[model samples]
Target: MAGRTEGADLKSVSPNQPGKDYSRYFQPPSLKEAKKRGKADVQVHYDFAIPEEMAGIGRGKHFLIRTYGCQMNEHDSETMAGILREMGFAQTDDEREADIILFNTCAIRENAEDKVFGELGHMKSLKRDNPHLILGVCGCMSQEEAVVNKILAKYQHVDLIFGTHNIHRLPVLLRDAMYSKEMVVEVWSKEGDIIENMPKLREGSIKAWVNIMYGCDKFCTYCIVPYTRGKERSRRPQDVIAEVRELARLGYKEITLLGQNVNAYGKDLEGGSYGFGDLLDEIRKIDIPRVRFTTSHPRDFDDRLIEVLAKGGNLVEHIHLPVQSGSTEILKKMARKYTREQYLELVRKIKAAIPHVVLSTDIIVGFPGETEEQFQETLSLVEEVGYDSAYTFIYSPREGTPAAAMEDNVPLEVKKERLQRLMDLQNRISLEKNLALQGQVLEVLVEGESKTNPDVLSGRTRTNKLVHFVGDKSLIGKFVEVRVTEAKTWTLRGEIAAKVEV
Candidate 1:
């Protein structure tokens, strides 16, 4: 019962409590409470309006948001930005110029945490220079007690601290930090009710992130997302369909439905009859050019979903199914709930249904008890799958996870060696996969100018492969056919063949 922590034993706190004594009104993160799964009904709220008193509080002020980690965090930042914009706060990229600064953090890895702390230390000088400036930390990191405790002890200049459940209340938290002498802390330990109609200041018109659901319930042993994100809850299908229709009407070229475990959508609803497949089947008929979903759990990926994706028009051919390990024993230790054979069988089904499907995956090396033979199995699996790309990482324990308590017998050098081997295999497979596309024509949705070379424009094919070519800047948001001339390990060099009619 991972991520089922409804009615968790949280510290009682009054809403919008403001003061120095954070413990009085804050429900800080607790692993014990987070593991509890009560039968509380998941709540849904349609109204989410900014507080009347704080409506104009951000007038004549500029804010900056530094986002880290997954696409969900990026979308959360967009919602926060939309709220701030409603309060009349403009956005700034320069740290020195911003009157308000917020760090939207991630807690998936220790390295990400270190980078955030390093940036916070640098921000100390900025805070001292402008004493009136308000600084905040939100997202998954703030949902952890240890992280919040460390911030309180080390980064006292931080004015506000909130968590994932209560982002819609940012106006109140920001206002309290501005007026109160002490830090304002208001974090909910339980899963939040669904809040719809929140404004989003998306990064680009070409691509957008639409969150169809929130939280995870699978509770993988090596992960902290279950606790930090709370239990599984989904937005109503009508709400989701309406949002997609609106995005289509607005001329958005692509919309990726996001979730911690996207394939588990609609399970926590009242009747629980509908699911992600049914939703996708409905979304595929929309006028939008392209649609995608991410971070799927293999256990929840069933035949219905695969069938819907097969009759694809707007549903892209790319699937990012994360197989954390290739060893059945390792997956058991990680609580992935699926065996190696089952995963391969799922891949087989997908390949049979969609002939030209471009598959990608996530792999982790050096789990606490992983052996050399287990590592080799991963390499063999990578070669067998022939994934177009893979995200590989060395295993690092997070404090509150069950895996952290296990004996970490694998040494650092061993972990690094294993990771390198995994990457090498995946890289070779990627190059081979891309090289097959040499001279093949692809429809690329032009995102924008290439980050490295402005003279060249960059885009992604429907399968989510990156392609770069020399093109007019005006083609930023349109789809065009490109002839792939050269293929590298990770990217493709291409030339525009024809402009696509919208």
Candidate 2:
């Protein structure tokens, strides 16, 4: 659920403010408290007051959404796009050709926030040139109090603003902003409720994102997801299954079950008996060719879940189990409940259950108070796990987390050096792992042409390894067996073994 390590290493940068750092503020609803809250009131209908003036305002308008962030934000953009299209807006790639521009932002990192602000400033000129341009900012960043306040006080030109909880209300929000010709700021900072039947314009024809649950209950001291995204809430299992079935009917080849903490699905519900494993079993029975889920926390991973993955009819063998740190001390400070041994045990079970499983992970190199010995623990874990791929980064502190207050003892140079060393180890391991497939044939779902070269097409193996091969453009959405001829650290090169069937 919480993907990255939170909090700033105080030793790395000079503290500009003097106080207990609220940098990583997450308020996870305790399971006890959730029990007392009782049945969540589900709001089924939105009061649609169509602004009279907006009737023809966007009659021939075209809009493009430049989404920046995780799968949650991507799915949110899909709903936003669907809502815009419902209001007679056509999609476009060129920002200059569009009447409306929306930025679906992320606030997990300071760099992310800075990029969004930079884009907003760039869009201001576009607004100045074409005064009718409707600029909106939504998503995690907008949910921040400071971000919203800055937008209200300085960037008054921002026509529309909303947060994660109220995406379904976009049509009305946009209409009101257009009609009033004034700033519209609406952001809710609290655990949110689920709104089902929200429309989505899925980005891919073959692959789709199906949200089985929402929010995170893990209040890792340095994380802000629990606050910004809200409490953990699972969609009705039937709703999720039906959505996947419909996607299959529409000829979708792949479905990724999206969630903040997918492993925690159904824990907040009435029975608490129907968990992620049960839901996976139901979905696996569906006719879809490929099924995958992301971002599982190691703590929630159990034998039942591992067994479900091992059963492996439709479930892809690729698991993105994020091990934020390897040191027990760092893990404790970050509030990751699992120890190094616990994580390795889980990994062993998963691999033992599902052979040839391609494992990927997220690793934070530097946390507050990390020492040479602690850093070695991370490196040793990487060596032991032999992760197929890893996303490694130096620690970045967010506002409102306990780690932000702790002195950052690891120097930036040390962080960089450690990160580089970690990456080097991962690269060697990745190359070694990929080399094992050099002589084998892998089933790869063709995504599209390779970004680096048009002569090649790229797709992913069932284990979620990227495979590039020479293939016809017509084979874009089909699954083909690619014979591995070369192996790179990050990708595999191959040729089509045979003509793709269907």
lDDT of each: 0.88, 0.80
What TM-score would you give candidate 1 relative to the actual structure? 0.95
All candidates: TM-score: 0.95, 0.90
Residues 352-411 of candidate 1: C-alpha lDDT, one tens digit per residue: 999999999999999999999998888888888888999999998998788999999999
**What value of lDDT does candidate 1 attain over all alpha carbons?**
0.88
lDDT of 2 by residue, 327-440 (tens): 999999999988999999998888889887878899998898899999999999999998999988888876655666788888899999999999999999999998998989
Badly placed stretches (over 4 Å) of model 2 are 1-57, 500-502
The residue-level lDDT of candidate 1 at 248 comes to: 95
What would you estimate as the lDDT of candidate 2? 0.80
Q: Which ten residues in a row have the lowest lDDT in candidate 1?
A: 1-10
The candidate that achieves the highest lDDT relative to the unseen native structure: 1
